[model samples]
Target: MSTVPVRTGARRVLDGLTRPAVAAVTVTVAIGLWQALTVLTGVPSILLPAPTEVAAALRGNRADIARHLAYTGYEIGLGWLTGVGVGIAFAGLMAASRRLRLAVYPLLVSIRIVPLVAIAPLLIVAFGATLYTRVLMAAILTFFPVTVATLDGLLSVPSSQLDLLRSVEASTWTQIRHVRLPNALPSIFAGVKIATPLAVEGVLLAEFLAASQGLGHAVLQAAANLDTPLLFAEVALIVGVGLALFGLVAGYERQRRWSDGTDGLGGFGTRGGGAPAPTPERALFGAVALAALGGSWVAGTVVVPNAAVFLPSPSAVAASLWETPDLFLTAAVGSLHKLAVGWALGALVGGTVGAVVAFAPRTRPVAGPFLVGARVTPTIVAAPLLLVWLGISFSAATVLIALATFFPIAVATASGLTTLPETHRSLLDSVDTPRRARLFVRLRYGVPTVLAGVKLSIVSGLSGVVIAEWFVANGGLGVLVNQGMRNLQPTLTYAAIACLFALGMVLFGGTTLLQRRLDW
Candidate 1:
């Protein structure tokens, strides 16, 4: 009996290795094929470098990569810490006060939609492109997801638990420390890990805006010099770092799984962190927050010399908009078209694939890299290869947007799909529903989860649209933003930024309407 049990245990261990082995083999074969095709076709390395060429470039440019990486590493490390600290503290404050939550959450969500790079100029004006500016940009980029996730987790603690604490007459502080904080850990980790790659992209965006010593600057420099191999190598390093950070957080979450009972990454405690439907009270508070922000902007001009140049007055920005009303209108239309197309494509694929994957969750391990790559392949990294293949076309830009939006939707969809209500599951089983029917039959139940993903996607999609215009397209609000930045025209940049903000509000407002319509 003992011998038989040992043999079965050994077999189980071997079985567990199969998917990893296959994944390794698949990657090796893909690389082998890539090398062979490039070598046989004699394609120019500038267009599509072979793996060996990229590897050689990596080795050759070790010193340069190291130098740039040091700056980026510093930005990411400090930014991530700051983001976590602020995000959690702010969530604590909001949890402690309903009025604070009502005031701040809506304003923050609206601000989060601006392409993170666009803020670099404002920061540069205030802080002079120093380490503080770069770190702050990254922290701001990372703040929303963490705060939303933590806030939701804290607020959504089970009624049973709250009642139990109340029955014992536990102090609010004691209850929060023992119950809310502990249960919120899973969601907290979920947001932190998800934001890790965003932090990397954030630092890169800051580098793009104004920096000489970082991977983003290095990419632009290499592209300017037409050094394709080095560009690919640098991009690979970025993707690797993002994946490594994700793996680190995910591994820890797994180890702590025994104690985690609340929804993992899927539910995010509540639908991904949009503010609750507005009441008159919420509207007044949100308006107060916006008014305060606007007041601060006005106040800054009085303090800074030459504020008109660096921080254009609202009237100047508004005048800029009026001056080129037609230009902005045209650009907004084109940008919206591309945004819609890419979002639709990503949503379709993500929801479908997520559903299929929900039926076979064992696939997640092997599928992990591709899913992570979808997010980590920032616009800066994709610029060269996409331009090479698509030749500055709409398709390339759409793909870039899709890459930004797909991961969140897919993750959320898969999570939601797994949670079919018990009654619904049994009903379907009793009728022997087909797999295809089953996959979508309960989609209504997952609408909240999927809607959460869609909201997140809209934010990321806006960022993609900005970068797409910067690199691929010739006309868009993004082009205006880039041109304004390059020309040292703050009013023009701010005007373009205002258009982007308006565009974002439109998209988000539409989503809100759709959510209300569904009301699932």
Candidate 2:
């Protein structure tokens, strides 16, 4: 009996260790396969280095790599902090004073829509290849998510709760602390999670544009020198750092949930699982916001000269729109076509792949790691290699965008499908629903999640397009902006920028409205 007890304890230890052991084996197999492929191709080492070679390079250059990592990390940390801080401050300001939100919202939206890559080079030139440029770019890229999400979170506090607080004569600060802050935790955390990865990626982009130090600059140098092993090593480090940062944010958010009365808010599980308390002032605030925005537009147009050289009036832009309707419209149409096709194809392929792997018992183990890889690999770096392989064609651009946008949709869709309500699944089984009907039910329940992912993918896909333009393509907005900058046509560059923002807002706003309609 004592011997049997020992055996049972050993078995439990082995059982507990099984998954990790399997994971190690999987990684080993992958590395072996990667090495086999490299040798089989007999290709230049510069094109696709073996894993061992990359690891060796990384180890040999640890000091240099560490320095670069630290520099890049600093950029990301500072920029992320600044963006989140400013975003939260702005959100609070906007929430407290509707006029401020309205006056600045359009410009903020416009700034958000413009691709950071397009303006990064300009910032580098202006800021003189310093850390400030990278920080600014990172801040610009991450700010919108935090600001928008925080604003939504703050404004999303329920009217009934506010009334209750008021009934107890809570001060504004008291209400915010006791009511709004808790309610906004989920949204703010969601934004923080998004900003986490973006901050890292944005810093890399800015460094690539113009940095003497940092992992991004290292990658660029390695690529330029055809040192593929070093390039991969740098990329790997960046990815690891990004994943670490993202994991930190996610863990903190999880802890926040645990500490916040098991639900995000205290006794108000509203938002998704529970009925969200309606904002008492949403309608009135929205009206005031729009009015203030319109007034600013009027002021901008009326007070600002039509041809202000650097900053043209809205009417001037409208005239420019008319003057080169074909140019703007055609480029927009081309971009949109590319975006829609790429996003759709990526979604279809990714969703199907995720679903199949998730549903298959054996494949499920692989799915999680695969998704993580896809999620962390910055798709922008792939653009240059893609351009090299495929040339400056629309196909290259579309493929880049597709790959960039696919991961989120796939992950979210899989998550939704895998976590269906037990009651709903039980009901379907009880009704003896066919496989097709069961799948349909699952999909319907997952639509909101799918849409949410798609919306985010669209946002991400636009960034890819901008990156694609930076490397390839001769006639897109990227090309136009590049040309304008090369020729020192600030006005034209700004004009193109304005158009880009308009295009982005159109896509974003259109998708938002469509989602709302679908919800209805």
Candidate 3:
């Protein structure tokens, strides 16, 4: 009369159905809570529309939503394809030549670190807010991740494999085709997955800035009119689009894993193995690359007719910096302060929640769905609604930054906590360690992963601050950018952008150095 086989079968079935079951239950509870709050609290529909109201709005405006979705979908599709193409090509080139990698990789990294919002206005000026501008913005956003991912994949082919190819006197192309490409496919798909949602974000940001007929535009209009239900509907649509794209990529990745029978791809892991010893060759090439960039900027401004109106010369931007040092300094301080505060708050909250979920296995099933939703929901779409709810203020911006910073930290913290060695946990349990002591030990062991998340949060916080300022706050680089764009002062706009880029580099570089020092 043994029930072991029946128990094992039950366990298998439970494990197989757990994820979807959790997700379904979470959604049901969330919708119920939303409706309950609105109905029981007597909150105005303008402030917090009930779930039913949102559903009605969706039903009433299906045609309009569909139209906008179509436009955004087109932009996302075009921009994503273009970005993947360019990224793969550039990654291949950099992989092919050591000198090129040394000379250009730093520049690419810098460009990628600079927030697109900082340059969106400049792009609008240069490209006149056309479909091209939107496409380019999306492409720019999608490019860096894909390039880095592909480059990592290309370089990750085992030395043994390379040697094998060399022994056969394989040409570089043959080596890549036979050895690198197949090995890199998983990583490339990983990049594609990362890039897909970002492509949606890029298009939404562009639409917010310039487009007349997209979900972004609708969001702005909804905010302006205080049409809460429509705003929710639009945001819902945007989230749906992002999730759809993300799901497609995730499905592909799952299929790939099943097909390849691998645990994970090498290239999908963290970049820059560790801090490298400084080299003269790297320094020299970096200098050369910077000089070339400056030279190109100067030439574009001086040689092209009225190019200074859009793409101002370095000297002109430098002059603007000199003339308005106070303005730039004030804005930089405001942005940095907000970013710091918001990032700290987000990390604190995310870490606590993640720790709790990790410690309480039962809680994870309930929390997982909400975490996924937060991670996928674009902060830009939430910004306008926040502005309306919270008003145009620093608090609003800080909230946005917190929202942007929270999910990554939470995910990282959970990952770090869950990955603790079983031996460590067992030893603590055997010793009957206090809960607090066990938690402390877990955090100490997880510092490296936590810090890695922090490093990422730095950039996320910076971007959040900029976008929040663009929509809500009166001070910061975002204000400088908006005014410069409206007033048609390209020099001021470019100068503000340059300051932001420098600030980002400093923060990002410092974080990287700290993470390295910690051997994270």
Candidate 4:
């Protein structure tokens, strides 16, 4: 009996090791298959280099790669710090003034909605192709998410706590320092984590579009020469930077006991306490916001010499809008179509996979690594490869959009499924419900969470489409932006950016409305 028990324990240990073993096997097989495909098909190295060739390129150009990496790192660091500082200041101002919050919050959100990639070229034109331009691009990318997150955290203080502070005669600044800031630390850290990879991506985009330094520039150069091995090597280095930054923020988050509950999608699970109801006050605030924006444009044009070269006057942008309505309309429609198609596809596939992983526990270990890779890999780094594989076409742009949209949806869907009440699952299990029925029920329960992810994905998908168009595709707002920058037409560039802003507002607003209607 004792010997039999010992044998059973040994078998159990082996069973516990099975999943890891299988995962290892799966990875090895996948890599082997990739190598086999390239070797057997006689594909040109320019189209898709072998992994070994990539490794060799990495070794051959290690010094150059490292130098470029340092440049990118410096740019990202400065820009991130600048953006975070500005975000903190803006958030503080909004928190202090109710009128300011009401008048300017929507405007800030609108700016946040615009894809930075689409406007990177405009930034180049405005700031010139200098380090400052790259840093500004990165800062622009970092600003919105950080500001929104910081604002969300600042406003999340409970009314009771605020009331207590008020009764004690605490000033606004005192309340912020003593209560709000501490309470918002977790959220601010969460936002920092969210902004980290984005900062890296922003630097890459700026380098690609403007700078002659950094990994992005190297990638572009390699692609131009059809040096696939070198291209892959540079991309891997870019991914490394992204992952390193992500890891640093994540490590800090863990140390602070902050979990990535919403997978870096801001305002997903947070309540909007400072949001004013639609009333005459809000109407007045809106009017004030428009006036402020108009005044700023007027001031820029009047106060600055040759302001149109950098900051095009609103009238100029409007005139461009009127003069080339079809051009703007067609580009807008094209980009929107690509975004819609790609976002839908990504959501469908990712949601399905997430559901499967949640229901089938046996598959989690096997699928986990690949999902993590997808989440961490910078899509910008892969843009050149995609251009090679799919060519300069809508298909390539759509693929990039899909990749950009997939990760958040999957993570959110999986989270939703896993967090379903045990009692609910037990009830379903008691009835011997079919697997499909169980999945549907879980999805229905998680609709709100899924919608939150959809909102984030809308922005991401838009950004991806713009990047793809800038690099590969011949149409869409990205192409228009490139054309504008090349021709030195600030009006055209600003008009395209304005259209992108409008597109973002529509998609984001529509999703939000749908979420409210569903009451999810």
User: Number of clashes in every candidate structure?
Assistant: 0, 0, 0, 0
Clashes in model 1: which pairs? none
Runs with alpha carbons beyond 4 Å of true place in candidate 1:
1-15, 18-26, 163-172, 258-278, 348-352, 359-363, 434-440, 446-448
lDDT of 1 at 356: 72
Candidate 2: where are CA atoms >4 Å away?
1-28, 98-114, 157-161, 257-316, 361-365, 387-391, 416-421
**Residue 108 displacement (Å), model 2:** 5.0
Ordered from best to worst lDDT, the candidate numbers read 4, 3, 1, 2
* Candidate maximizing lDDT: 4
* Candidate number achieving the greatest TM-score relative to the actual structure: 3
Q: What is the TM-score of each predicted model, taking all chains together?
A: 0.87, 0.82, 0.91, 0.90
- Where does candidate 4 have its weakest 10-residue lDDT segment? 265-274
Candidate 1 CA-lDDT value: 0.77
Colliding residue pairs in candidate 2: none
Q: Using alpha carbons, what is the TM-score of model 3? A: 0.91
Q: Model 3: which ten-residue window has the lowest total lDDT? A: 258-267
Q: lDDT scores for all predictions?
A: 0.77, 0.71, 0.79, 0.81
How much RMSD separates candidate 1 from the native structure?
A: 4.4
Tens digits of lDDT, candidate 4, 498-519: 8998998888888888888865
* lDDT measured at residue 306 in model 2 versus the true structure, 0 to 100: 39
Instruction: Show model 4 residue runs off by greater than 4 Å.
Output: 1-33, 36-42, 268-270, 276-278, 426-437
